[model samples]
Target: MLENLLPPLNDHNLPYPDTIHPIVVHFVIAMVLFAVFCDGVGYFSRNSKLYEVSWWNLFFATISIFVAVMFGQIEAGLALAYPASESTLNLHTILGWSLSGIIAAITAWRYVLRLRDPKTLPIGFIVVGVVLTVLVCFQVYLGDELVWVYGLHTVPVVEALKEGVL
Candidate 1:
């Protein structure tokens, strides 16, 4: 039924569509994880240098998130093979947008406060980054559920495990 609304699925065995399986999302996810670690270091060490590095990570994440959003949007149109896929896609889209907003707000806060006083920044970083990290974990789980449960998309590792594609 839902398949009637989508383009005919191509069975030519082409590598996954560019939109559904872009390489940049991989790099973006890595950057987000690295940013979380940097934030952790900054919070624990209370060092200005570490805090600055954390801010940079957040900045990178914000930019990458935008790119990921674009690719995800394009992929959504192509991957509507089942009804469950649509629900998972909607959930992922909401989580991604919320996470992007949180990361952007935190990055802006850190940047605007960077020069005024070094001491005040730690508490802000500790609070915001910690909260954002927790949210990121939740988003990660939503992403997993989208892929694993709904069968909306594929990652190389999962593709290998499920299909022996490696």
Candidate 2:
């Protein structure tokens, strides 16, 4: 199926060309994409099916994001073994956890509202999804600052340095 064809996470931690990091990055990007799509559907159609799908997407996305965050932490912990930058890593961790919590709350609200009358879905979806999008955007901006500006993740580089592979 088209769904199964999506790239998977790089659990093996291999040094080869391909890894799970890109997959995880895409996964987070997917959340933003889904949010946009769901919001559009809910806003334009106001259809129960669209509302249902949006809530389900948000619920699954929240769980997946938490998993990706754990992977980030593991990568950070490994980086800490050497001369890794602590400030950016700490910021990344804090922002990631905070965003995860917010997403979880939004997911809960979506589902709880979905269980009620279909009319209730739009108001909750608009309010919660809007709030979540703003928060997520802020978190993502912080993440970009951590990586591109500060270079928090030195794990792969450090490993390469140790092995003299580069």
Winning candidate number (TM-score)? 1
What's the CA error at residue 143 for candidate 2, in Å?
2.6
Off by over 4 Å in 2: 1-22, 80-85, 119-124, 152-166
Which residue pairs collide, candidate 1? none
Clashes of each: 0, 1
Give one digit per residue, the lDDT tens place, for model 1 in 1-166. 9758656533322234434434656666666677667667766776557666666777787888888777776666555435545666787788877777777887787778776764446555666666776777777777777667765544453344346543
lDDT tens digits by residue: candidate 2, 1-166: 9748655323233333333433575576576558657766767776556665666667678878877787776665544222344665677678778877877877777667667764545554576666666766666776676556544444465456457654
Once model 1 is optimally superposed onto the true structure by TM-score, how far is the C-alpha of residue 31 displaced, in angstroms?
Answer: 2.7
Where does the lowest 10-residue lDDT sum fall in candidate 2?
9-18
